[model samples]
Target: MYTLSLEVVNKCNLNCSYCYLGEKKNTSMSIDTAKKAIEIAVHEVQKQYDKTLVIYFIGGEPLIAFNVIYEIVAYTKSRCMEMNLKYMFSITTNGTLLTKKIIDFFIKDKFEIKLSLDGSQEVHDLNRKDYQNVGSFLTIINKLKLLRKYEKESDKKVSYAHVVTKNNYQHFEKNFQFLIDLGAERVETGIDYYCTWNNDEMKGLGIQIVNVFALYKNQVQIEKKRIYWNLLEHYLEMYLTTCNFYACKAGLNSMFVAVNGKIYTCIELPEFQIGSIMEGLNIQRIREIAYVEDKLSESCINCKYKSICKTRGCQASNYEIHRNIYEPVEVKCRMTKVFLNLIENNFTSQQLENLKIREDR
Candidate 1:
């Protein structure tokens, strides 16, 4: 479950409206810094007795710094082999820069590719526009077509990183169906916490989730499609485990390495530097990040749904808006309550029991 996210470059070709990184720098991670990052990351995972290490490529668009990724993968493979560890590589791209050579490399390496596509063209173009303010839907969908052709050649399946914004929340159903039709094996839809949300918009989004999950339920029950959606997975996990798992595991199970070689718990929280590749992780800061939830505001801790709530919000998001991770995002807390309540009202008790039985089987 441990992940090392490398912000390969601080540059991106697109100027998406809701980019959480705020501003992009022209910096890229030097091979030396990357190697040092690998060394420390491998050491951390090993010390914990974990056999797997997920070396994730993230950025202003990781493909822009693809050469760094190529070199890092080679070095990591060597180190992992020596340590008798299993290594995984994954990248999230905007899908405007696919080429045969790149696709070939991805296939050969068995990369877990996630395309940062927001859904249908109209809805996508709303925010995910290139520097020229042109919609990137056509470019991405075309690239996706090429990727899918390669997908048939191997067992690798493509997943999507869907971003929901206040502007596009209403179109989520259509956008999600479009991706499903385009043969997405998995979709991890996350809200655009960079933007502000009004109470009405938040409620509308909750309604969208309830409606979408109804479709999701039908797909699971009637068609038996094996597609995975993150929200549904979280809901099911909450039901089965009765554990209020937080939305993010940054400080506890993950670390994000920025292009400057500084380490943070997440890409969004640039200010929360836990350490650097040169200095190594600050155990105290990491431990504080791991336990940030327990130190939430008194109101959040004593909320009626605190024990069952799944939307404790992300540390990065909380810090981005509130300048403090412990201060919960009102919209996130409210949406969690609304979505779960709407879901409870939507599904019959027998259906819930049936879902539990089916999931267990």
Candidate 2:
């Protein structure tokens, strides 16, 4: 799989506190740049014989440059058809600029849409606000409703991408349920590592995650509904199998292209830029960054749970917390251990005994 993340624009209508894109530069991708990016990405995909190519439109808000996206999608579809390549289009947006026309275009193109919704109106409005200091909750909710209406008419499912922060940790379950109530079938969230989480906040987050997991299990077992909790799904998958140290795809098969055509291994870690689309990718730099082992600390290497733990976590978060990609953030690692412990403690002796008995039979 090959992923090409195009930063369609660097300008946003709303300001989120923890956005990786620090400030709006009022810059958007020109058609020439967009065409060159697609051409280069397609060439690489063909050269590598990649089975699938994913063109992800990301930014301050991709819809801000809807025209550019329109052209790129049209061109990509045509080019991929000519080459007989498998490809898909996706976008991440704040959901404030969605319109019926935009929704129609997305449906026609079968684009996977991810809305940046934190949770309930109050929780989301606290950190995600517009330049005028106005909450965008109502506006986004209206757009979500419109999206839901259209989604029912199409095969594509609209999902929510949430960012969990200290302000919203306590209300995690409530916010999750709120999105579910708003017709979101898929809800994915990750911790905002930029925020300093104290001891109490970490415990609160652990409790919230356990509670949500229990609720999710009940929904699957009793209610028989398919609910996708992105964080829990990922951890559960890792818990049930051996952990791979270098799980991230950055600098390997994935690359982030900025609005100015600069390329980085990971979108969050812009400091380590590999190359530019115009100049072409630095394969040597990519190999050096991607193949470097020993991302774990000495203590982590000898930890009892090393085999099952995601020691590498997120490179971006590791860099943000420790100012070094190789050093694991102690706080984040502790939080992960707390969540894993909760998962381990939830299964009772009787439950384990029953599983053992079933396996023996």
Candidate 3:
């Protein structure tokens, strides 16, 4: 399975404080560029081992360029109609621009829509605000309600993603509950990786994550609530499977295409452009990005948590913080070990058996 991401527009309506794409530009992917990207993803590239591709649309906010997304999906569907491939559509949106028409389109396409909602109104508004410095939670909540209504009356699945920042680190359980209450069956979270995280914040965040895991366990094992927590499920899968999961899959099987046709391993590393749609992928640069030695570090190989830590990081993140793609971020490493320890030290034999049963089903 591979993913082809199109940064439909380098523009957004909201001016989020923690946005990685710091500056807003008027750039957008034209129909010609998008078609070229689609062709490169499906035809120009060889995919003998795969039969599925996730055609993902992202942006400062993708809905701002909905027409491009609409056209791209249609074109891709037509292009792949006869190929031995099945395609899926997904989008990450701020939820402010979702209209009945947009929602209908998503339903018709069966898009895996991930709505950006940071838990509660206060927490969400603290950083996720509009250009005028107003909170967007009020506007998005009504849309979320409408989405849940549609899901209840149909077979569509809507997921929620929230960022855990300094503003909401202490409210982990509450945040999860708030999203769950809003009918979010599948929820995911990301930490503000670029933001300052001192020892105190790190400690608090670790505790918050542990508590969140405990809450997930209670919900599933005791309360009989049905939900999906990305972290917990990932750990369970790691424990039960062949320990196959990537900390970051920046340049392998997945590639990010910008509005200007520049290709990079990940959106987080715009400066590390490895290729362009016009020139195809830079194999040498991609290999270098993955590291020349085919290894991250000697220390990582010898580390006790090698299985959990092998693919445990984004090269872009490493380069950003340490000026080296092969090096791992210290704080994030601590957090990953912490995340594993929570599952290992907390889950009982019976609970694990139950988890395996859930997975089997």
Q: What is the lDDT of residue 187 in candidate 1?
A: 85
The list of candidate 2 runs beyond 4 A from truth reads: 47-50, 268-271, 342-361
Q: Write the per-residue lDDT of candidate 1 for residues 201-318, one digit (tens) a residue.
A: 9888888887788777777789888889887666665554454344565666678888989998876455677889999989898776666545547658777766766555466666
| Per-model TM-score on C-alpha atoms | 0.90, 0.90, 0.90
Total backbone clashes of candidate 2, pairs 3 or more residues apart or in separate chains:
0
Model 1 TM-score, all chains together: 0.90
Q: What's the lDDT of the predicted structure labeled candidate 2?
A: 0.79
RMSD of each: 2.7, 3.8, 2.8
lDDT comparison, 1 vs 3, better candidate: 1
lDDT of 3 by residue, 1-361 (tens): 6789999999999999899988888688999999888887886334636567788899979999999999998998887776767788999999999898888788788788888999888888988998799999999977866686557654767778999887788987799988877777888888777777889988998898888887777877798888877766666665654433334455667889998999988864666787898998887887666654434465476766766553354567767887776677766766777776877788798978898787776
Alpha carbon lDDT of residue 347, candidate 2?
67
Cα lDDT tens digits for candidate 2, 295-320: 56775877667777765555666776
